[model samples]
Target: AARLRAAGEAAVARHLQGQVGRAHRVLMETPRMGRTEQFAEVVFAADQPEGQIVEAAITGVSGSQLVAG
Candidate 1:
C-alpha cells in the first residue's frame, strides 16, 4: 500500500516485487525425418504460478518457422 507517484523509486521497486517469481527456460527438440532441415529447437519459459509457456523462441535449421510466445 505504498503509492509510486507520491513515493518515487522505493515505491516502484515494491510494486515490481509484487510480480510472480521468475520463469524457467526449457529447450524442446523435435527431430525431422526425410527432410533437409535440421531438428527444431524451441526455447520456452514457464509462466507465473501456472508453469506453462508464456514466453518462447523457436528456431529451425534455416532460421525459418521461428516463433515467440
Candidate 2:
C-alpha cells in the first residue's frame, strides 16, 4: 500500500508539473496588450541662440533619466 501511494503521489506530481509547464509556456508566448502614452524629451542649451526641440520615443526610465529609443 505504501509503494502504491508513493507511485500515485509521483504520478500526481508529474501531472501537476506538466500543467505548470504548459501554463508557463502560454504566459511567455502570449503578447502583452495595453495602452502606452507617448512622451518626448527636449533639450535647451544656454549658448545656443535658438532652443532646439528633440523628439524621441521614450522606451524606459532609469532613475531620473528617460531612456529613448
Candidate 3:
C-alpha cells in the first residue's frame, strides 16, 4: 500500500541518518542521540571535495548517495 511504502521510506531515511547521526555525534563530542540533520550540509555534500576528487559512490538505504575519494 502507499502508506506502507511511505513508512518504509521513512524507516530507510531514519536508518541512514541513524548511522550518520551516531558517528557525527562522536565526531562532534556530543552525548545525545536522535534523528538529526543538524549537519545536513555535510551529509548532502559528503560526496563533494574542496581540493580532492570523489572516486567512488556509496549508496544509503535512505536514498542518500555518498561518494568517496
Candidate 4:
C-alpha cells in the first residue's frame, strides 16, 4: 500500500511537470443580463502551484442568439 501511494504521488508529479508551460483549452460561461455568454474557447496555462490559472486568452465567443459573429 505504501509503495502504491508513493507511485501514485510520483505519477502526479510527473504529470504536473510535463504540463508546465503547456496551453490547455477551457470553456467558460458568464451571465449577461438574463442570458449566458459562453466563452467557447479559452487558452489557459498554469503559472503556479495548486494549478492556478496563470494565463488565459479568450479565442472565441459563441455569438449571442441575437448577435452575429
Candidate 5:
C-alpha cells in the first residue's frame, strides 16, 4: 500500500509538473466541519500568474483517471 501510494503521488507530481508547470501550492477545504477536506493542487508556468489547478484524484489505481485544468 505504501509503495503504491508513493508511486501514485510521484506520478501525480510528474503529471502536474508536465501539464501545469511547477507546482506552487496546495489548498484544502472542508465542505462541512465533520467532512473530509477536499484538496486542490495548484501549479503555474514560470513567470506567469495563470496556470492549472487540479483537484485531488488517484491516478494509479486500475480504473482511475486524472483531468487537468
Candidate 6:
C-alpha cells in the first residue's frame, strides 16, 4: 500500500510538472496584447487659471488639492 501511494504521488508530480512546462511554453509563445497606460504632456491655456481637472468617483481630495493615483 505504501509503495502504491508513493507511485501515485510520483505520477501526479510528473503530470503537474508537464502541465507547468506546457503553460510556460504557451506564455512564452503567446503575443502580449493589452492597452498600455496613456500619458501626455498637458498644456494649460493662459486664460484658464485652474487648467483642467478630471474628477473620478474613486478620486480623493486632500485639503484643496486633488490626490491622483
Candidate lDDT values, in order? 0.32, 0.31, 0.35, 0.33, 0.33, 0.28
- State how far residue 45 of model 3 sits from its true place (Å): 8.3
The 10-residue segment of model 4 with minimum total lDDT is 31-40
- lDDT per residue as tens, model 6, 3-65: 999898777555433332121111111122111122211221222223233322212223322
Error of 6 at 41 (Å): 46
| Evaluation by lDDT, superior candidate among 1 and 3 | 3
Error of 4 at 38 (Å): 21
Expressed as tens digits, the lDDT of each residue in 1-69 for candidate 2 is 999998987775554333321211111111221112222121112222222233334344333223333
Can you list the residue pairs that collide in candidate 2?
Answer: none
Tell me the tens digit of each residue's lDDT in model 4 across 1-69: 999998987775554344434444332233211111223222223222222222333223232221111
Full-model lDDT, candidate 6: 0.28
User: Model 1 — TM-score against the truth?
Assistant: 0.22
Stretches of candidate 2 above 4 Å error?
A: 23-69
Summarize candidate 5's per-residue lDDT along 1-69 as a digit string, tens digits: 999999998876665444433223323222211101223332222222223232333222221222222
lDDT of 3: 0.35
TM-score of 6: 0.31
Q: Pick the candidate with the highest TM-score.
A: 4
Task: Give the number of the best model, judged by lDDT.
Answer: 3
**Candidate 4: pairs in clash:** none
| TM-score of each predicted structure versus truth | 0.22, 0.31, 0.35, 0.38, 0.31, 0.31
User: What's the true lDDT of residue 17 in model 6?
Assistant: 37
Better-scoring candidate (lDDT), 2 or 3: 3
lDDT at 45 for candidate 3?
Answer: 32
**Tens-place lDDT digits, model 3, residues 1-69:** 999999987876775555532333211111211222343222233323333322222223235522111
